[model samples]
Target: MGGRGTRAVAAVSAAAAVLTGALAGCGPMDDIGLGQSGAADGGVGKGAALGVSPLKNPDGTGPGLAPITTSGDRAEARKLIDKVRTKGRGPKTGYSRDKFGYAWADSVDGVPWGRNGCDTRNDMLKRDGRKIEYREGSNCVVISMTIYDPYTGKTLDWTKQHAAKVQIDHLVPLSYSWQMGSSRWSESKRKQIANDPLNLLPVDGSTNASKGDAGPATWLPPQRSIRCSYAVRFAQVSLKYDLPVTTADKDAMLEQCT
Candidate 1:
């Protein structure tokens, strides 16, 4: 990794350092700094640490988008979601994934895991999932893994055979981004957003397909319990790119944590 990828990693590291250990506590409130529940753990947990509270992993540098189960954490989630700007969606004309870059392209600049000889999809898989198995003699191609599907609140025994068993979701969907002024953005910026780890999640394939370019107003994770944190992740991606969701989408995002 170099350029933006390096900085993204560093920024995430800094943000995570203070809360990483605290996140291991029993409740969602402990994911952030809701209160002093107990003694701090030694350090960051492993990739097996799925269902990580989104409140503590603001940069999307951690694991699964865990549910905001506690009232305190839900309140914090709402606050984050509330900050996202709102606008009407724009035209989708001339929009295509290629405009951003190749699917999961590694060459995108200014994103975590970019230019690291691995595609964004596999990078996300390794980041949020565990029990990973890479292709023989190739570390970049993920052949299999067991992942927590936060959207459905289920664990999947995934393999490459049915690639759709798991998918890399763009928290801010590419088509949604196109409508939210990304259509006019430079190709580099588009590619950066497309590949940025902060905007990506390895999630349930069916749920991701169902979301298909829709914003929070029209779609949410199937596991209603995780909605607030999902909205927070959406807002984080939007704010990072200086993009705006539709007014309805913003409102719907607020509903999740309230």
Candidate 2:
């Protein structure tokens, strides 16, 4: 927590300053639950404060990915990106989703939100979503929530019925990881990277699908303001696992911070 951390914290703090107080008069808005009425009545407003900056949320446990504003934070982001090693991407011959363990297994040890009775998807839904509604009789199951999709800068009134509308994106896509040498990793290591909150983001599904296995070199969030933050998150995951990004991807990431 140096200059970079302090500045990023200040950015989030200033934006959140307006939201410090609770809802004043809980009249009709409280009837259908706070967030349940949001989508129907246009209650959930859009703003940059909907999330926390990657500069402060290195562990990715905070909330959504907030844009990284200010020259200082961008400079700091570039420094972090510079630390990631770069190499030519390998091959994708023997990779599969199963190779990283079943989707969102709570049983995976050593990662945040793991083995917490809820699966990783719901955990992320709870973590990034605001005004959450849970399925009846289950605290771990999320029925609906208001989410700010940083990838597209859209606020969604997401429900379980249309589960594919929002997807948890891997900042470093698993297939990309395979090409970057994850195929040579132990199953446990692969699972850690796959389930690690630091590498995951709840974003617009279509945007994420369009990303495929492409790195920063080829794909990025459509919201220009969030690109640097996205690049930083990518670097965080790479550094944490001692993984190497492709040279092109690393260069692209550095450019985002500028």
Best prediction by lDDT: 2
Q: Record all residue pairs in model 2 with backbone atoms less than 3 Å apart, i.e. clashing.
A: none
Please give the lDDT score at residue 219 for candidate 1: 87
Decoy 1 TM-score against native: 0.80
For every model shown, what is its TM-score relative to the native structure?
A: 0.80, 0.82
Tens-digit lDDT track of model 2 for 60-137: 876778788899999999999999999998888988999999999898998987888989898888777766788889
lDDT of 1 by residue, 1-258 (tens): 789999999899977875675465543444332111121321223433445677787666666676778888888877777778888999999888889888988897777667988778877777765666779998667787777787888888888999988988888989989998998888999999988877887787777888899888888888888788888889888988999999999999988888
Model 2 global lDDT (CA atoms, 0 to 1): 0.83
Task: Report, for every candidate in turn, its global Cα lDDT versus the true structure.
Answer: 0.77, 0.83
Off by over 4 Å in 2: 1-49
Instruction: Return the clash pairs for model 1, or none.
Output: 4-110
